[model samples]
Target: MRYLRFTNWLTEIDRMSGPISAIWFEEVRRHAGTDAAHVYGGLMATLTAWAELRGVPCEGVPVGTIKRHATGKGNAPKHAMIEAARARGFDPVDDNEADAIALLLWAIETKGGLA
Candidate 1:
């Protein structure tokens, strides 16, 4: 199977969200500079750089904020977040997708509108 590059995805998003608005990026847990943390942190940095190039404001949202907004608890389990998406009538493909969905809702609700 072929996978899309992160830059490609970001380009698509930049195209869709024209005029460049604020980007609400969710901050994941960084455990003393683990690999996961490094990769995610790098991705976020790249994303922020791209947003900067386009003059888009990027804001980092805490993971706990996403969980609390989506599941009513900051420490909700993965399954609970999935259930929360289901409860909201979303059929998220996986936990990551569910997280994206939750963050999307939070961004829309809290940040007025998307770019």
Candidate 2:
């Protein structure tokens, strides 16, 4: 899928903000050899590159935004999201991936992708 590479790039994307405004884990910085600021910055850079290649606009909401929208709590557990996914009629084998997709669906709904 077109998003496969994008997802990989996201992992390597440098953080653009420090821990203060950063919503992701600090280990993302440590493993990426950059601060949260640089990682987020790199993420934007990668998005720009991908958009140029695809000739389409692609904007991503913050993970926290997705999480809060999906479960009513920003720090909801993976299993909770998986349960939500099941309720929505999608069977996800992996809880974390399920949660992420659930968050994606939540964002889509908020953006009027759903009726």
Candidate 3:
């Protein structure tokens, strides 16, 4: 049920955003608990499979890389990431949104928007 909901959400996002040029996700290496790790693995697998089936380029940006890019530190805290996103003119509602914004910026700068 969770996977179904996630895939449905992904489909809605893709529909609203038009043809996806690429897909980028944070590569989380560590988790506080086994359950979290398992969930992350499942989500990652689902996302990669979805992207593969659609022929959309997919890449996982390391957590440290995103933190460093956003806060000049490899292990920046959630608040620091949020500040960084705000500094980029984004009003992220939470750490996850802030990280997403940072990831988008990094992808655009590094891949030239995957052009």
lDDT of 2 by residue, 4-113 (tens): 57655544453333112112211122234456567566666666665556454455555555556667776668787777778778889988777667656764576523
Model 1: residues >4 Å from true position, as ranges?
Answer: 1-4, 16-20, 31-33, 112-115
Q: Which window of ten consecutive residues has the lowest lDDT sum in model 2? A: 18-27
TM-score of candidate 3 against the unseen true structure: 0.89
Residue-wise C-alpha lDDT for candidate 3, range 61-111, written one tens digit per residue: 899988888999999999999999999899999999999999988888778
Query: Candidate 2 lDDT (Cα, whole model)?
Result: 0.56
The TM-score obtained by model 1 is 0.79
Model 1, range 57-110, lDDT digits (tens) per residue?
888878898999899999899999899999999999999989989998988877
Residue 86 error for model 3, in Å? 1.6
TM-score, per-candidate, Cα-based:
0.79, 0.53, 0.89
Worst 10 residues of 3 by lDDT: 106-115
**Ranking according to TM-score, highest score first:** 3, 1, 2
Whole-model Cα lDDT of every candidate shown, in order? 0.80, 0.56, 0.88
List all candidate RMSDs to the true structure. 4.0, 10.3, 2.0
